[model samples]
Target: MFGKTPAKEFRFLRHIAFPLRIFLLLLLISLLLMAALGQYLSASFEDYLTNHVRDMAMHQAKIIASNDSLVEAVKNRDSQRLSEIVGKMATGSDFDYVVIGDRNSIRLYHPNPQQIGRPMQWTKPGALEKGESYFITGKGSIGLAMRAKTPIFDEQGKVIGVVSLGYLVSKIDSWRLDFLLPLVGVFVLILVILLLLSWFFAAHIRRQMLGMEPQQIAQVVRQQEALFGSVFEGLIAVDPDGVITAINRNARKMLGLSSPGRQWLAKPIAEVVHPASFFTEHIEQERRDVLCTFNGLNVIANRGVIWSGDELLGAIISFRSKDEISALNAQLTQVKQYVDSLRALRHEHLNWMSTLSGLLQMKEYDQVLAMVKGESQAQQDLIDFLRGFFDDRQVAGLLFGKWQRARELGLILNITPGSQLRHLPEGLDSTEFAAVVGNLLDNAFEACLNYPESDKSIELWLSDEGNEVIIEVADSGCGVPEALREVIFDQGVSTKTDAPGEHGIGLYLIASYVERCGGIITIEDNEPSGSLFTVFIPKVKIIYGSSSNDSDC
Candidate 1:
């Protein structure tokens, strides 16, 4: 009947708080177990009492049968003598009655005087004649009882009569009840204790779960999964033991792991990320914008700890590819360079306009025309030269802006003749190319600033010829010291003494880009006192229709 109830009837349980649900379920289970145990123990106790009573009755009957007086009394069929002996033995005993019977099954002695002369009721057929001693349960003169019968023998060892001792079934049942009451009390006490324990246990579990139900927790997990998957940055979460607890799709992809995140779950973070000290070291401290390599991919990573009150739970690391960061930096540098170039051009134009205005006011028409023609032709020629050789507009614009910037710094800038770069090498983009050329040129300009205006000069050479793009930049300035030359490309190494942190990263960044492209760069002392930096990047054959590009580099 309970099974036939509709499932919807119990659906309200889902709405209940987690602790109450757990307590109720535990209580129900405890009650069921206690009921089953109570039933079994009660039945067992009753059976034990019944067996004990039956055994007592049989023992008493045997003792009565062995008595020489009772045997002689039965042999003579003396009811008075049988009663006298049985009464003495029955005093201070547990049995309900003791009866003595003759060979004809006539009662010689009974607990009741009226039963003494009556034929014994419920006697087994031929039991007295066959001299059988046994126990039986049956309705007798008194009531239903467990009776043990023992045969009596004469001096010749022949069956004379029987002695029957009985205990009432109702009395045995009463004894069972007397024992069961205490047992029931113990069971009730145990059930009450268990219910209290269950309530505390359930409350503890609820607190551990942040007081949320199973359904609520499930919903939270789903939301977290969606959020993690949708994020652009790669994310990994590890437990306090350094085991991976969660990894997002972007994390797996960034780590170059093709297997699903579930396959990597519970694995040690060290196994997934090499040199995992970034995560393991100083775990309690939050780290941001840390440059580290994960599975051979350089990434800008940040790590933060997960906490529960005062306890440390674990840590989460979010990272993105360093190449992406470099790209963004490159774009921003290009924009700043353009802005500076425009500012310098504006200042230079104002000076030229001031000169032109002065000449026009003096009415020196010939000098004005000559100055205008010369300035326009010079600018036009440089623009045409850059457009003709450098096909990429970004690289061409970078060169033009640096040339203008060098002029504004009162330094002569020369682009070596026959320099040609038709197309950038494979794996190199225009923005990165611009960054490389711009940094080199900026360094040269800074170096030249140390010399007098008349003596300051910077020269740039670019050529994509015979399977390699070669670039050389030479500047007349205080050259790199012999001691610092080898470590010039290392981060935090620079000729400029001011700005300890800000001035050293440019060369390091250039070296990084160069190494990633499988290129070579070298620094040499230019004749007549200056530094010359040369770079060589090999070119690869391109197949236009292929999905994957093949590069020897």
Candidate 2:
């Protein structure tokens, strides 16, 4: 676990570097190369100067040692003659000094006027060694100088004194500078060219990057808006600050927002959208998810953090209306209620039969007979009515459930019987079919119950017409207002004023289930009074056959 690994950074790093980075990298590399070249040129120039100085010393020493008169002149301490000799040699060669010194190791014949008898501790080695040249550097009374010395001998071959010559090294240093000047000049020129190249490439790279073109990005944004706007549910996006950044066309329509004159863009989210808890909840919990109804619109929102590298940029939230969620839940609850009621009724019926059996065992025959006759007559009438009204068990169950519910609500339900239709759809499930019947019954109950006791009335009629199943439920209650009829099936559109917590989803649930089951619904004013709602569903192809039982009585 502790072993070194390749950097995790590069794995996620795209080509994130900008043009400035390229320019700087190239400029730094060019500067380093120029510095290295300048160092190399300086070293070569120094070596040239050292070699030239050594060569010049050797050549001057040979020329002075070949003169025999120079040796005798050095032994006599003749300064005037040595001066003349050095002057003459200066004209023929580049040597600046020639001197002859006595055997006492003192200068005898010298170029300087004051040193004719000066001791020659600086050149005694060359004075004793014949034809040998010695090179030395020293600071004399005149200044700093480099000198060459050689011993001069008479015709008898005995060394008498020394011949000395000197040359300054300042000239050699000047020559070295002359050689390096062009190299330095070339290095500076190369740097300028590199700078220009870096700038040119940096500018070109900036143009090539897609981020440089804002118009293209704007076009993409427009396309995304167009695509999302056509969707059915309303969608909204917000930033970390709870500001509404974007809203699709559907969302704008649902919320009654207009973009033409209003400043919707970049507006504080709370101004356009209510229920700030959508964003705030996520921020505090690090889990930005909210599903709630706000200002009559259901919204499900999700918030997530936005990040670049190790930096936290902010947060983004995306949400849509929760209408579908509510619709599904309502439908399920209605079905569950129906099933529970059916089970309870079945259990109660069993208990009632057991009670009757105990009464019989106690020999209370007259009391039991009277109670049985009353129950039997009621049961027979209900069974007879349903047997003639609905042939499908799926539809029959819904009708029975609705009857039970209406009695509980203190409403009188009227039923009209019709011949059983033969064919039914194959794809229909029992739950969906039951919902179709249940919703109609619910609508009938709600509509009739809306009237005062003196005006309450309900009628349900069923029949088949040319490959279609038709049902009509009419109530002796004030009909739906004409203007609001078109919107009755919409979620949250309800006519009931007395029912608390009623979202007006009954008609919506009915319409939605019918559409899903390939059926349709319509509404109209009943003749003379009240409202009439009709349902038409395509006949299904059924292969099975069954016989109907007589009325329970």
Candidate 3:
């Protein structure tokens, strides 16, 4: 009662090391094949030897029957003559024995003298009656043998006798064994070589697989997919030839690829990522936080190489859209601006409180009232102007904070005459607009603070008189150098040299935001010794009663 199924019985094979398992399987197959081949060759050899011996016996029998001496002896009933002729032919030959019989099947000559007069045993009557020559295997006077029988004919063409030539089956088998021994040795040698090669091949294959089992490799692939899907950043991996090997869903989405990621596989990285130099150039080293453009979208990218020992396999690139980075930057900038405004207000309020306390202590109540009136009127006037001109609350708040910030830094900030904004440009929201304005104004403020002039004043202008919204910020500070003016908006290019990574991204973010909104920004020299930055953004057309807006700005 064999209870175990084949699968259960062979389940232990799963635990074997992959190379060993391969070797064992290959060895088993080779052994089986060689065994079957050996059996086939053995059987074929025996058949060939039997046929060869039979053919030789038949030819020898015919030749003996045709001999005039043997025929004359048999015709004259001379047994002595028959024995002499047959003995000479059989000696030192492959035949075991030769027998001559009369037409009546009486033995005329035999290997044994006593059996010469006896009738030959196992003789077929048809062979003699029909005067035919044939071959058969049968037990005879000596032993089991393969015999050829030929009928002898007289001068008158009448059957006078029969000739028989025989070879012992046992002797033929012994001959076969002797011939096959060397071949068997060769087969064994070949089998050994094959097994060795199979073992080596299996070991080589195991090394290529990094010694991981098939199941483990599959599990790792699944884990990689999960990790790629779960990550927020886009990821792409390339081989040493710069062909894309793996790309995740986020990468496709960020690159605005509509087709499945598989379609991009094996394609050149340059075909998918514009300006792929960040990945292709200096591929041996790791790069971090490198800003680059991918498919026309600004992205913060990092690249690292994959290595096996000292061999460079490929590289993996991880990146996210600069919009996400800009959003974070916008929030941080707002927070910093808010804190700066609070600090500036706190310091100014302290000064006001000290003045009021001094007036109270001196008992100058009239001066205190006048000072309070002046402060309230000035604050109310500025608030009224901002509320009436700027429709967006975020932009209004930003302008107010920058104004206070300028005053706190001992700089005059001016809102140019007859400047107003009824609507922001299309595709540009208040948050982004605030970031753009904030960065420009902060840059101007920094320039004025760093390179102070006698007239350290900054001018802000805004207009939405036509299809485009225009903004200009001019500062009496260190203007951009002629060498840097061309590349000032490029990432990592900045007039400020104090900090490396921090100071260069503001203008880049501004330029990127403006470009996305179909706007243009330009820089020129201010009248005296400052830079004037102007932006013109196309606005969206609004239908008075319709809900939808078109791109007819």
Candidate 4:
């Protein structure tokens, strides 16, 4: 193993970690700045050189044209005299060439003597023919040059010839180099400083990362993937710009996405999660537990800020389905209520048993028989009434629980004899139906407590006829106030004093569930006394109903 390469060793040198990447990023930015600066410096130098060279050339040429010797030579129409004066002037000046051309554009003098007496060739169009002083840059007999041309006029004001002073483009560059050399030195020095900083940062970052090998970093990435994948709750991580950087399978499931790599990653958070408000805020403890209907799932989210040392990275959101929590709570509450109801029934039965035992122990057999028969008939009537709806245990248990609660309060619960409910109603499952029935019965029972024992009674009528299920609950207590009747079904509108997490949600739940399944609920006054609540549910399609195969409570 010592002879072999370490598995975590970097195979290539370009393994830039986060800090190193930052350093490279800085390097790239500095390089771009240098390039832009170089371009600007080069352009400015060329412009300055062009103007300085042109002005100097024009001044020298104008001085030569004003000389008496050049004027006398031109007046005599003497090419030989013109050549001698132009040759001497060119030698004395730093200009590349001082040439004299006749008005017919015949070159009388030039730096290249072989070009003399030839038609003067200027690279630009209309060169020297416009008879005006100007500067132009182009290739001539002496190669590319920036030349100043001025037309020489006779005393009669007629143009006789032209004089030109030319400076090589390369010569202009020599002057340009004066300023550019210092700029280039500064550029190189800055680049060296940048490189030193980059190297220093690279070393610092390497130490911080403990010089982890490529394989080790890859292993860490895999570990992260496994960690996120193994989580039960949804996990999503976003960048500072609100783009999803990482999302787990559970997140995909919660978000109703296609798969892990199907553009979900790196997509903007707004487009991935609906309503955009779910993960927009910097969610901490006080702001955590965001409840939103995102991606068609009711999720309760807890968002935490992600940071790298002192820098803020983004946010990590963990969420669970609200349906899961609700289901668990519902189960626990149902079990507890059922147990309480059964306990109340057992206490009542124990009292009955005590009375029957006392009667049997005495020497009163006929009175005992009459008492037993009366009790048997009442219990049988209650059983028969409940058996009508026993096809669904949820419905049976709900009504049975209500019956026991009424008895504990010493209130009469009357089920109309004309009522017939065969099974769970259409469009609502047993649990849904039970919840609706239970909440109504609880409200009725609470209302009945407002009256004296003699007047304490609740009337429940259930009938399934003509493709509709009708439920009516009439309480013999104070009727609903006329002013509050309109908003009675709204959430948090309970008539009772609210305790923590225990009040004002039942009616809201029932109304929402009714609306979901397309049903109607109404409130009316019961004859002679309290309030009558009637619910009409149409039988169309029952999708959430409990079947015979379902477990019994």
Per-residue lDDT, model 3, residue 524, is 97
lDDT of model 3 at position 118: 86
Winner on TM-score between 2 and 3 is: 3
Poorly placed runs, candidate 2 (over 4 Å):
1-312, 343-358, 366-394, 410-415, 419-430, 454-458, 463-465, 476-483, 499-501, 513-520, 526-529, 538-553
Candidate 3 TM-score to native? 0.75
Candidate 2 per-residue C-alpha lDDT over 336-383 given as tens digits, one digit per residue, 9 for 90 to 100: 768855875576567779989999999999988988998778767887
Off by over 4 Å in 1: 1-7, 218-306, 312-335, 349-373, 541-553
- Sort every candidate by TM-score, greatest first: 1, 3, 4, 2
Return model 2's CA RMSD, one decimal: 15.5
- For model 3, residues 495-532, the per-residue Cα lDDT tens digits are 88888767677788788767665688999999888999
The clash count of every prediction, one per candidate, is 0, 7, 0, 0
lDDT of 2: 0.67
Q: What are the per-residue Cα lDDT tens digits for candidate 4 across 223-304?
A: 9999999999998888777888899998887777887444788789888888767566643223477777777778788888
Candidate number with greatest lDDT: 3
lDDT-wise, the better of 1 and 3 is 3
- Candidate 2 lDDT trough over 10 residues, lowest sum: 544-553
lDDT of 1: 0.85
* TM-score of structure candidate 4: 0.52
- The per-prediction CA RMSD against the true structure, in angstroms, equals 5.0, 15.5, 6.2, 13.0
The lDDT of each candidate is 0.85, 0.67, 0.86, 0.77
TM-score of 2: 0.46
Q: TM-scores, in order shown?
A: 0.83, 0.46, 0.75, 0.52
